[model samples]
Target: MRTGAAATYDPFASYADPREPLFTSTVVSVIGNIGMGKSTCMKCLFVLRPLLLGRRVVVLDKKRQGAEGEYGPIARAMGTQPVRLVPGGGPGASCINLIDPRIGIATSSGAATSEGRPAGQLELVQRVIAEYLGHSLDVLGIEALRVALLAAPGRAAADSREPTLLDLIWCLQHPHDGQVRSLYDDSWTAADVYGWGREAAATLLVLANGELGGVIDGPTSPEVSVDHPAGLTVFDISSLPNSGPALGIVMLLIQTWLSGLLAQRSAARQQTILVVEEGWHVSSSASLGEMFREQAKLSRALGLCLVAGFHHPSDLPHGSPARALMKESSTLFLFGQSEEVEVRETLSIAQLPRELGDLIRSLPQGECVLVKAGADPEHVSIGISDWEAAVTNTDAQLTGDAYG
Candidate 1:
């Protein structure tokens, strides 16, 4: 029903950086281990592409979430410090972050209460909340959320104006209420689904708290603090134990929210750029990978520009799922990768240069091969002249006090 016939839809374009011909969507996988410059490469592209070309941007962070003082400062310098958590302090615990601004979606802990009140049952809340996190989020403003509307595309002045991993997740999870749904009844246009999602998130929060009430009722408990809207939304996971799944879900859901937002913007003749670092962790899941693939299919229509940075191609998953990603990746950036047979196979299937099979062996940190349509993949050296290692920027102002 939604065609990408917006007056401003511009096809993505790029040159000789890749074996593929000229292309639009750029896929750069920075392959390296700890201390290696893998993340640095991702940061460079995150800042470069948009600043140099007036591209609307959204960067996904799952590894550590914020830029620490390092990456956070960089993002702030670029635009808005990525959106971070406010606080999820309720009778029970809400999986939702109070501070997230961009998407305004709430994640729930999941627990059923006779009258929206619970003593403390984290597990039950989480289960109930799971549905909210997995569903809803198409809404931007609603219950359990107190954030503001973010700037329109091309309106950001900072280097990065992104929603924190949490903010974006909440947005994707939040149902839009009766908004787009009224005009378009399809799933893509169903905005009222957001209210149901919030209820789900609230249920989960109560459940999360029920299990960890000991911590919440304690003196050190984090109280509920609402956040103002921000250009960048961040879901700080520094406190959560065993954060992999939580982070993965956050990334996937946020990516989905952005896809839908772009679709709406496309209809309005606007374009935006989105970037994801540590690409494999989120995109590797079969279900999650499929979501990314589906979003990619609409990238051109919504004027959605995307760049995914990862370690090894294998990290993205195997077989058909990984293969599908290759097709979506119009442009590919290959940094030095460990000699994983699977990684090589990924490149082979992606149509990487046969000669690079050996060259890929010697690639170093900061350097990468750019692949796009009509261009022969060429090795690019980002060595010394590149920006400083983009660690998590902790220097940015985080309203920890309000969170308290």
Candidate 2:
């Protein structure tokens, strides 16, 4: 973790000329192996340092420790608690509506559509359904879902509330002939539309009433808000199962909501950094990856910076969009990786020379290579205060008599 010389790295420091900037965007990718101090690096450098500068930090914490998320201690130290979301609505649970109109307007080509909802919202809902069904929806199925989404708001108007997944489901189960034919040709009948949408509706029915009930099927919980005065927000989704689409679905919902909320705050000129640990959950999926790619393009304009951490670039398949996204990061922090395949993949993605493979593999804990675009990579060690070391420690549970 030792370098020839020590210099401060500030991503926000500006140059005299606007045309020639130090970095293109604030997007960062931190890659390393498990237990290689990836989280520690992110906590100290991104979370702690950014908070000191009056910047907001939002974490989608997926790593569970004991009964809470790994970032719980950090949140509590900042005078806030992680927004722990539990399934089936318990004593302390948070919910986010899938179709909340507050999601701002989605434009086709710089112009707001007549639907008055973000186009991403429609894609989000469709992606959730596709996740549940284990495949993409067919043409008729996609049209049916679109028609149902368009009708959901009107259906919920009777109850004087915002549209929820339940309302969308109801609309799908009962397709309006006019709406169906309007989307397609006049030959499309209500029964035909109902058949096309029946499977998707049934899939959504299981999602709303099954094990994940109350998580996203109902109205958004008042407790859910991105603008916390303490300048730190953690969505504790650790309770979600790691193997299924549940985690990916919830991540998408949270990310979409964050985009909408941040879009509204564009005038405030507040800079926010969003951290997604175990980022492959978003990048591995084609749908989620596309959504995130679009969001990353807008990160600069929205006054937002995305800090995504992955165990290694090889976690994604070859030619994956995730790899492309990693290459586009303005800054990269690469930690020790023992496996040769992983080492080579990391180097290839970071565009580093193959000769550095031995150096990367031999990096000690709390040490990493800082790679910035248009600059030579620097070997740096992460130095933290005693208090930070105490707060960022993740080995307390394993510190007892066994090792001693």
Evaluated with lDDT, which candidate comes out highest?
2
* Number of the predicted model whose TM-score against the real structure is largest: 2
Model 2 clash pairs are none
Question: Hey, what RMSD does candidate 1 come out at?
Answer: 14.0
For residues 260-350, could you state the per-residue lDDT of candidate 2 as single tens digits?
5676566587777888787544433466566567777888788878788888677787666577678788888999999998998888887
Residues forming the 10-long window of minimal summed lDDT in candidate 2: 103-112
lDDT, candidate 1, 90-196, per-residue tens: 44322332223322322233232432322122222233245335554333323223211121111222435432323323443553444445434665443444443
Error of 1 at 8 (Å): 23
lDDT agreement of model 1 with the native: 0.44
Q: In order, what lDDT does every prediction score? A: 0.44, 0.77
Off by over 4 Å in 2: 1-6, 14-22, 86-89, 104-127, 134-163, 167-201, 242-244, 279-284, 400-404
